[model samples]
Target: MSKSEDIVINWARRLQSLAQAGLTYSKEKFELERYQEIRDIAADMMAYKSDLPLAKVKDLFCNETGYQTPKIDTRAAVFQADKILLVQESDGRWALPGGWCEAELTVMENCIKEAKEEAGIDVTVEKVIALQDLQKHSSKIFPYGVLKVFFLCHKTGGHFQANSETIATDYFSLDNLPPLSVNKTCVEQIKLCFEAQADKNWQTRFE
Candidate 1:
């Protein structure tokens, strides 16, 4: 995105945050109206800069309550031999099996659940291998802040099977990967997971 577009997105995010806070804490009706106006303006900014419909953008901004924070995305980096597990997503590109963390879901539980749901595999989360801020690593501007959590998982059981969001599952060597969902799990990050798996010295990387 251009610097001007960045400015618009940043301004819109800030305005949305401020508006949310103002709406949450302020008791006065006039104050509430002003906050609502701020939210509408923020949504307008998003709509003007992006292809999203204004009404959808408005709903995204206005539907939630309280402080907005980075949404967590849990991922499992499961290895079979020297290959990594990658699931064919609904969008056609492949990615590590995982999604938005549900209420009270532990990292291991979420990882295991996602593995079963998307890849039809049972996994035991070995450890958290990486924690990343998606905006820092990705070129696309995500509508909400995202905190990506990747786990090095141990495969236990189950076979490749299709699910609602995933069409297929397979393991691929690091040297030869399938078309990847770069927005979710990229080649560089996948390489890091491989390295971490091979060496006990590999430390958890964070951003």
Candidate 2:
């Protein structure tokens, strides 16, 4: 992001934090009104930059009630025939079969569950390929930060199955890949997984 855009996002995050703290603790009408105004301004800033409507942004922001936290995303790069498994998403773009991690599961379990749920296949997670902060490494931007963990998984069993979240599952060669769901999975990250899978001496990558 440019310096100006970074400034805007920083201000938005700061204002959101203050508003949350104020709304959580203050009961006085005057204080609540002022905090609400801060939040409204923050929403406007975000909406203006994103080209989204103000109320839409406000609704997206107002639903939270505590300190903002990074969302956790997990993905698996399951290799077969020197190709990687991916599922077609609802939007018609393909991504590694993964999504938000469930709080009830360990990160490893989450990776396995995502593979099963989104790809309809069983996988044994072999090793961590990378743990990255999405905003830092990815060109794609979002309203909130995300911590993405990419795992190298071995297909243990089960055929390609399509669930509500995905339509079809297929393996693609790196040289001949389809359009990616950039927010969840990207070509660069998938390449890293391939590197780790091909070379046992590869080290874990992080940012």
Q: Candidates' lDDT values, in order?
A: 0.88, 0.84
Clashing pairs in 2: none
In model 2, the runs with Cα more than 4 Å from the true position are: 25-29
Question: Residues 138-194, candidate 1, lDDT per residue (tens digit)?
Answer: 887756788989999998898877768999888999989999999989998899899
| C-alpha root-mean-square deviation, candidate 2 | 2.0
Please name the candidate that would achieve the greatest lDDT relative to the true structure: 1
**Can you give the TM-score per candidate against the true fold?**
0.95, 0.89
lDDT string for model 2 (175-195, tens) is 999998877788888888789
- Model 2 residue 161 distance off true place after TM-score fit, in angstroms: 2.6
- Candidate 2: minimum summed lDDT over ten consecutive residues — where? 136-145
Candidate 2 lDDT: 0.84
